[model samples]
Target chain A: MKKVKVYVTLRESVLDPQGSAIMGALHSMDYNEVTDVRIGKYLELQIEEGTRDVDTVVREMCQKLLTNTVIEDYRYEVEEAVSK
Target chain B: MKKVKVYVTLRESVLDPQGSAIMGALHSMDYNEVTDVRIGKYLELQIEEGTRDVDTVVREMCQKLLTNTVIEDYRYEVEEAVSK
Candidate 1:
């Protein structure tokens, strides 16, 4: 099996209100050193060896359902998995 | 400034309902190769140079606010940022 890790982040042009809120909270808590905060999604997928290569399958999934292409960007890495 | 990338994931003991839902959707769409999926949070913080070391500041933030210690675990990496 292979484990694919996908990271989905908002487009650079997008404004992350959630992140801004968190930054503001931190500043209030005395972490004034933090200038900015941006939040994103991280996903890990375990795939059994299939007909297509793992890379192809992951890319297809990302584009189809894992991310919103218009306002978000996604990237992934595949690693060997330790089966249970 | 330094950019700290923090990934917060549920503990192995915790369940990920969202990940399971996505996996089910993928299978229904004929992507049966995926066996399991887990979802987590990815955060990036822009930190100004402070009196304390970056590592110390990051750890404090993660413990106090970025992650819920009981159910989630967090890890981070720091990279130099291009000032605007």
Candidate 2:
């Protein structure tokens, strides 16, 4: 089996209001060393071996359903799954 | 400046309904090789070097605000940030 980890984040040009809010809150709480905070999404997928290459499958999924390309960017890593 | 990447994931015991919904959609769209999906949060923090250690700061922020320890687990990686 393969385990795919995907991270989706806002594009540099986009305004991340939520992240800004978190940073403000942190500063008020006296964690002033934190200069910035950007929040995003993390997805873990379990896929059984199939006819398609794992990389191809992941790219297709990310392009089709996993991200909003207009404002966000996504990257993924695939690895062999060890039984839990 | 230092960059801290924090990943917060739901504990295995939690039910991830959004993940299930995404998986169902993927199956309907014919990406059946995918067997499971889990969703979580990814946070990127820019921290200026200060009197306190970055690791300690990250751990404190994560415990107090970034995640709910009751139902989530978090891990972090600290690295130097390349200028944009």
Candidate 3:
């Protein structure tokens, strides 16, 4: 089996209200050193043992359903899962 | 300046309904090769130029606000931000 870690974030041009809210909260909490924040999504997928190209499968999944490509960008890391 | 990438994931003992829903969707789309899916949060923080230990500050943020200690675990990667 293989494991894939996917990270998705808003595009640079997109506005992120959630991130702004968190930034405001941080400032209110005296974490003024924080200048900016971007909130995103992380996903982990466990692929069953197969000969299929895991990278291709994962990227397809991200593009098709895991993210909204119109406003978000995504990247992923794949690793071999240790058997039990 | 420094940028911290935070990944927050649900604890192994917790149930992830959203992930299960996505997995079902994938299976409906003929992605039976996928065994499991876990969904989580990703955050990026931009710290202003400061002499304070970036690692300590980032970790504190994760523990205090970025994650729910009762059911989630978080890890972070810190990198120096490129000056424009």
Ranking by lDDT: 2, 1, 3
Provide i-RMS per model in Å. Answer: 0.6, 0.6, 1.1
What TM-scores do the predictions have? 0.97, 0.98, 0.95
Q: CA shift at B23, candidate 1, in angstroms?
A: 0.8
Comparing only chain B with the true structure, the TM-scores of all models are 0.94, 0.97, 0.93
Lowest summed lDDT window (length 10), candidate 3 chain A: A48-57
Tens-place lDDT per residue, model 3, B3-31, is 88899999999999999999999999878
**What tens digits encode model 2's per-residue C-alpha lDDT throughout B1-84?**
999999999999999999999999999999999999999999999999999988888999999998999999999999999888
Q: Give the TM-score of candidate 1.
A: 0.97
- RMSD from true fold, candidate 2: 0.8
- In order of TM-score, best first, we have 2, 1, 3
Q: What is the lDDT of residue B42 in candidate 3?
A: 94
True contacts kept of each: 0.96, 0.97, 0.89
Q: Once model 3 is optimally superposed onto the true structure by TM-score, how far is the C-alpha of residue B48 displaced, in angstroms?
A: 1.5
Error of 1 at A19 (Å): 0.4
Pick by TM-score: 2 or 3, better one:
2
RMSD of 1: 1.0
List candidate 3 stretches off by more than 4 Å.
Answer: none
Write down the lDDT of every candidate, Cα atoms only: 0.94, 0.95, 0.91
Question: What DockQ does each prediction reach against the true complex?
Answer: 0.93, 0.94, 0.84
